[model samples]
Target: MLALSHYNSSASPLFPHFSNDSAGKLEARVTVEGVTDQPNFSPGQPTTGGVIVVILSMTLGIISNIVALIILANAYSLQRRRTKATFLLFASSLVVTDFIGHVIPGALVLRLYLSGGVHHEDSNSSDRMCQFLGGSMVFFGLCPLFMGCAMAAERCLGVTKPLLHSSLVTKTRTKICLCVIWLAALCVAMLPCFQLGSYTYQDPGTWCFIKVLSDTEEVDVAFVVLFSGLGLTSLAVALVCNTISGLTLVLARLRRKPGSHHSAKSHDIEMVVQLVGIMVTSCICWSPLLIFGLMTVIHSYTRSIGDDLLQYQTLMVMGVRLATWNQILDPWVYILLRRTVLRKIYLITKCQAGLRGNMLGRWEPTSFPSSEKNEVNQV
Candidate 1:
């Protein structure tokens, strides 16, 4: 049976620290006894299994995000069209942020878990690392969220206000909007760092989570609530706007004539589809975590049924999983939006020597006139 003394000593400082050692020990003994008496009380550690899962998840996520970034960058470099370039630039920004969010922290978490110690040696270092990690999470995560919304808004304007859009949504305007998104995201993320000390690092035996709130009221709860709410609200608004615009475009296409310029219509449909996909994916990945986080904040203020701690932890873990999956799937959106990208891939494959012979292979032979063919043969 696990002793209460050990558990209490190791309890995260972010939570209410129990000072009565005797009482804690007594409670711990009772809890351990009760668990041992139960039929389903298997208390063995699952470190090996957890570590393996972390390693595989981190490795796969890294590889997938790298591939996504490469695909987007390559696509961006190949395109010359203004609209296509704008989409690629937006996609590239998203990919870069997603890469940092998935790869860096993931690797750090794995290392911390495997070593059974944090990378930060002292309290100050730990605090700094915590703030750094927390800030990075907020910055990178929010960038794509806002950029995506801007992309949607631009698309909507392009469709609904074609004449105005031609003048308003110029390359300069797009770049400015993107710049604003990054600045806004950074400002929102760093606000917490200034007021609250670094996020407390807690090892829950399975995964790492930031401890924004401390046991003492050292940080203003209001600031945390306000900033987090603002960030989430912005992301939610973007997602809704994007989804609406995408659906409108799709419906308009459906209502159009069958003989409409098929190529142009198809391209428009593809762009809308890609925007819708990105918006839906972002919402799916982020909403659960945001909702659960809000609930946690509310519960903290009320000091109510702390019994739901386990459930809250589970939800947070699920949220992390959703966020990480975003990195893996981002590449498909780039491919769907960019035509020059597809052409380049085809060209690259065509240049390969062995790939030339097959009829449906990468390369095709040029046809000559019969007269030319005969003259060449006669020579």
Candidate 2:
């Protein structure tokens, strides 16, 4: 998501210009240019299909995130150990962020659709709303990525270096880390308000976000590049941490003696699995938006005015749509992919297989696999 700001009459052709009185009161007078000033470059209205899809998906996302939060709360209350509690803290924060990600910006989008979309000229109140939405797009967009990386790092330390993790990771430190992550994202989002870059209405006029223009000042281009770089770097850190944690868990399980037991091993595996889901989801959903923004910056010097501009706008719209899926799909990772739920799914599949074999008169009841037996004992 991007942001919008009040600009002068010399604003870019793609954005509106604002004026104010001597007393700093926003005047009623505002001007905006025609899209591209060419029939061939005019963008279409937000389609009914698109509006319906946003409404339904946003609704579902909000509900799912709420459900995930509830589950996390319940799980947190049942946990007596410090490490698990810390993880639940991080998970709860991520779910809350995802919920707000869908609610605040999603509500703004629905308002635009219901009101028949933004016009050539917007009122001061509307401009402020766009600014809020743009900042939200940046803040919420980065929070999940940052949180995923944090979670993965936490788990990697726990799985690969238990003694060190126990000594270093505490509830107080975890809470502070969450606050720092949010503050970092909020600071980046607010940088535009300090004139590093400006937000403007995106293609089709349904949303506003960080300006991704080729003709903008060098600072603005660098701002977009900075955002893209942060997102990609977060994803990279998460991928590396998740890989190390998973491999470490596998090797540990293989090395465990038949009668030996580490009660926390199962919990660590569960947390690692959840982190992998988050890493994969973030990578799949956000990579396009981040990569597209970077590509636009790299090619800004060679960008054309007519068809190329249209292509950029269209692709960005699609990229944002993909990015929104991250929030929607994130909660389900915790909801459906739990160790208990997965164990149930495995049992169901095994039962079905046994039934099929019995009907074919080749049934032979067998003992549970050693791994399955171990999981059952742990539970």
The numbered model that scores best in lDDT is 2
- Judge candidate 2 against the unseen true structure and give its global Cα lDDT, from 0 to 1: 0.75
Model 2 misplaced regions, further than 4 Å: 1-44, 120-126, 301-306, 349-379
Q: Which pairs clash inside model 2?
A: 2-134, 2-208, 2-209, 2-210, 3-134, 3-199, 3-209
- Scored by lDDT, model 1 comes in at 0.56
| Local error of candidate 1 at residue 358 (angstroms) | 36
C-alpha TM-scores of all predictions: 0.70, 0.80
**Whole-model lDDT per candidate:** 0.56, 0.75
lDDT of 2 by residue, 114-225 (tens): 6766654542323787788889999999999999999999999988888999999999999999999999999999987788887776656667777674445577688888
Root-mean-square deviation (CA) per prediction: 10.5, 9.3
Which of the numbered candidates is closest to the native, going by highest TM-score? 2
TM-score of candidate 2 on Cα atoms, chains taken together: 0.80
Among all windows of 10 consecutive residues in model 1, the one with the lowest summed lDDT is 1-10
lDDT of 1 by residue, 16-52 (tens): 3345665877777665443222211111233666667
